[model samples]
Target: MGLVERTSSRCAGRAKAFKSPGAWHAAGFLAEADLSANAIERARRAAPAYIDLTSSNPTHQGLIFPVEMLRAAAEPYWFARRYEPDARGLLAAREAISRYYSGRTPALLVPPDQIVITASTSEAYGLLFTLLADPGDNFLAPNVAYPLFEHLAAAHHVTLRSYQLDESCGWQIDEATLLRAADARTRGVLIVSPHNPTGMIVQQPIAALERLGLPVICDEVFAEFTYRAPHTPPLAALHPALPVFTLNGISKMFALPDLKLGWIAMNVPAASAFGARLEILNDIYLGANSLTQAMLPALFEHGLAFTAAMRQRIRASLDAALAVLKGCPALQVRPPDGGYYLFPRVMCQDDEEALVLKLLERGVLVHPGFFYGCEDGTHIMISCLSAPEVLVRGLELIVETLTT
Candidate 1:
């Protein structure tokens, strides 16, 4: 039978779980019971505009890139464009990624042949899921992570086992929990340095990861936004013996998400064993477009100053938000090491959904902590990736609402 026929046959018995005539793999995501999402929609439709404290998109947050610079970068590609396809993406783009990594603090020297390009980080996750796990096999991912993994795992027909990140210990990985989450079927471990929503960088998990003897998938999309640490080291640089797949992109690095380019930089051993297979998988789709690949070199060369300025703006916003939130007696917040989010514990008896809804009624919107797998307490996620004045005002409203 053909691939489609085989997939249809596999999903034949699972029709009841699906809302439509779609693959059984995506049945769980067909519908979801999210009270906070519903409340946000209703609140937006009502009177009195709301302040969005959970805004993270750089484009929407008033961080504009230089149009002339972007134009200049793409202008050359328009005139000199030729359709040359490589299974691993454009050679020049991969070389540019290698050069960018070489400029990091620890300076990881990645070879162009070891890198595989994808359209976006989301697509990179999908590709990695295919590369690492079979239908029934699983990968270990951190708890309190962005929800993207769950969706990606579902689409790929794999399971994601959760490992704990101890909030009391600055959200560091609990070594014991991590080991316990692994089993014979475990294919790899996913690590998000400078974690989303909480902003905790992976400081000391290399030794523990070595014990597991599994490949590491490090997501470093927010690597450049470090606030507390002197600099965030590439996990690949820290561990030479282990097979590390470092994922990053221009989306967060240069706020160019629309351009659609992300990549996986494989360590030496990983490339030696699995590079051929990954190249085959990437060749089937060749998902990344040619225009962005041509512009990547220029983006890295001219975009550093812009990214540095953007980081300073985010730091100022974070500082302002922390200062205002500190005055609230009913909330307890710890400063994050990196990234643009603040996860603060609500020192109240209100339920997570109720608290989010209450804040929404008061005209400010913040994500409930449960959205990011926070189960220990009632927490709310606040993004400082907004305009300085807007972030401060939104935080002030959160304080007033909780205190009253």
Candidate 2:
């Protein structure tokens, strides 16, 4: 027999009689699995119909793109002529990234040496998680942050503890709460600026959080798209005194998630030991794509115009969505300072999953607030990057449902 089979056979006797409930094993261990499987099966069988507000992809959501620009983006690189970046990514690509950042915040002064491009922000997270914490060490995250980090943290064996982001103040992380969350085991803090789902910049609080003696992993993928305030300086610029691993990618910046281009720029004080250790970790992985790195110089120079126009289109859609949502008094939107999303709390005691299922039944796909680690109440996250007509129609339907 296989190891599992043999172990199961050996443990089948009378141990349960002597064991505490927690210490019970063998067939009883398998009993929990059986019960869980049955519960999941029953829930699936009993699922309610719904219109989902969970769609995020602009491409799939019927947004128009410059077809010619897209066609050109796919013209394959001359692989024979292309090769790996110098372990730190190509200098030209880094220069292009520097130019991109410099154009927005001249005061930020992003150095080419500080940037290490990855294929996606997810990879950047994996890299930074491994760099900042040993297995079993902790990173503090915003309570209602994106849920992807749970899987990312698991892969690196890093524990993530949630700190409340005050929803009363449009869901910005309260500085005091963050400071309380930090301890000797806390190696880093991850904040999503123009945060995912909630879409608000933690402007005033970011500085205070930085004062705590831990590295910061700021995900600013949505920096280019904001609905309020003159765009705050990217967090990389905000705290050069502390170690900051700032991540952004072509996915959100250029609306080019297909290109698989993301990067992490190390903005820690150059003298810090963390800075040296991260470089060694980056050198070991060398995870960047060379051809995409090669594409950066021309894309940043030319693509900035495309991105600027896209930003305008998204803002128009955001305005349209807010207006529609405002008409529905039962649903209140949390105004976003920057980002391609909005979080709207609706008048429903029913869990977000139930509400999302209700919407999905109406042929709308939306993300429920609970999906974003929200525990307190029901909410829905809708993408502002959708085509304007769909945004309008979706909100009308939402209003109709809320009123009736």
Candidate 3:
């Protein structure tokens, strides 16, 4: 049997065996492998310290939070503690998000009613997958995207098809690859501006996708952290006629991942049809807590200083990493336009996973290319979100491994 058939049969067997509560796992995503973490844990127990090049959490990387401001923002929720759940979200929070979008180019005037708040962008993806597709319908995404999409689609019983991102063209969307991947069962197309790992801003062919009549789901969580070029413009602004759902959150935007808040800015004529149904979906879990919703306005306004500091830190880290890697001839590094990752192609004969394990043994932890669905060659992604000293040390170890 083919992959789909095999996966379906396996899912059927699993469903029968467990009296299947949800069968979300049997949807045939990658196994929940913790091999990288396992390797890192073993190395750490045996050694004094390991320079983790895969560090993406901003809070752990030494970002100072405005504790007073954040505390004050959430204080109001406690004063008026009552369950006033609006299936869409608190209007005030949505209004705050709308105001945030009002500052975008072309002035994306997203009404508070059009916004659907969720616990995280990952939740937003689940909502969208269910809203746009029936089971067995698929969405096309970039081959080099973050792995979360695979899990999200699998959870919703949706298949994810990956189109190519032309690495030769600064990882722009490969239209031919995309066209070949889609069919009548394709429900939507997912794009990530300042894409994770590769940090490539999507210059989507809006006119072509408009013809395909598929809604465009653009994840712009890292839209603000540009170095080589201007920040990526809102994908919704570029193509107003096309059905667009722009996903962003306080996670990457304000370095507040633990805040657990995200929203979808809907910008299309057909969005109205989705509103009531989307509200029903949001109501099912009501995953977003009112405390963060209460804090969002102040967080958005006051968190600028924190985000500014982080952007500076990431840029500096990238420059420092590039400077060190310049001396290492075996690895090729392309500085990303945005995002906190540096994915470098490694010149090594060993399998990527084995190389990752070897690097772990050498007291540095980094992600192998295959971890992010990279099949082109031996590549590994390191985070530029680490502290400068830690990042420099990690890169030095990586260089030693590559050259030796």
Among the numbered candidates, top lDDT falls to 1
Candidate 2 TM-score over all chains jointly: 0.84
lDDT measured at residue 329 in model 3 versus the true structure, 0 to 100: 88
Could you give candidate 1's per-residue lDDT for residues 248-357 as a string of tens digits? 98899899888899999999978987899999999999999999998888888998899999999998988898899999988889888999999988986458778877
Regions of candidate 2 where Cα sits further than 4 Å from its true position: 1-52, 62-84, 205-207, 268-272
| Tens digit per residue, CA lDDT, model 3, 1-404 | 11211221111221112233356763343443221334334444577668878767788888757789888888888889998888888898999999989986447888998999999998999999999999888899888766677667767878888789877787778888888888889999999988888988754445657667788899999987887756678888888887889999988888888989999889855476577788898999999998999889888788878888888888998899999999998887888888889888887545776787788888898877665767788888899988999999988998898788
Name the candidate, 1 or 3, with the larger lDDT value: 1
Residue 94 in model 1: lDDT: 95
Residue 237's lDDT in candidate 1: 86
Please give the RMSD to the true structure for each candidate, in Å: 5.9, 7.7, 5.3
Error of 3 at 66 (Å): 1.4
lDDT (10s digit) by residue, model 2, range 166-227: 87888877888888878888989898988887877856536566578677888988887767
Scored against the true structure, residue 25 in model 3 reaches a CA lDDT of 66
**TM-score for each model:** 0.91, 0.84, 0.89
Identify the leading candidate in terms of TM-score.
1
Against the true structure, candidate 3 reaches a TM-score of 0.89
> Each prediction's Cα lDDT score?
0.83, 0.70, 0.79
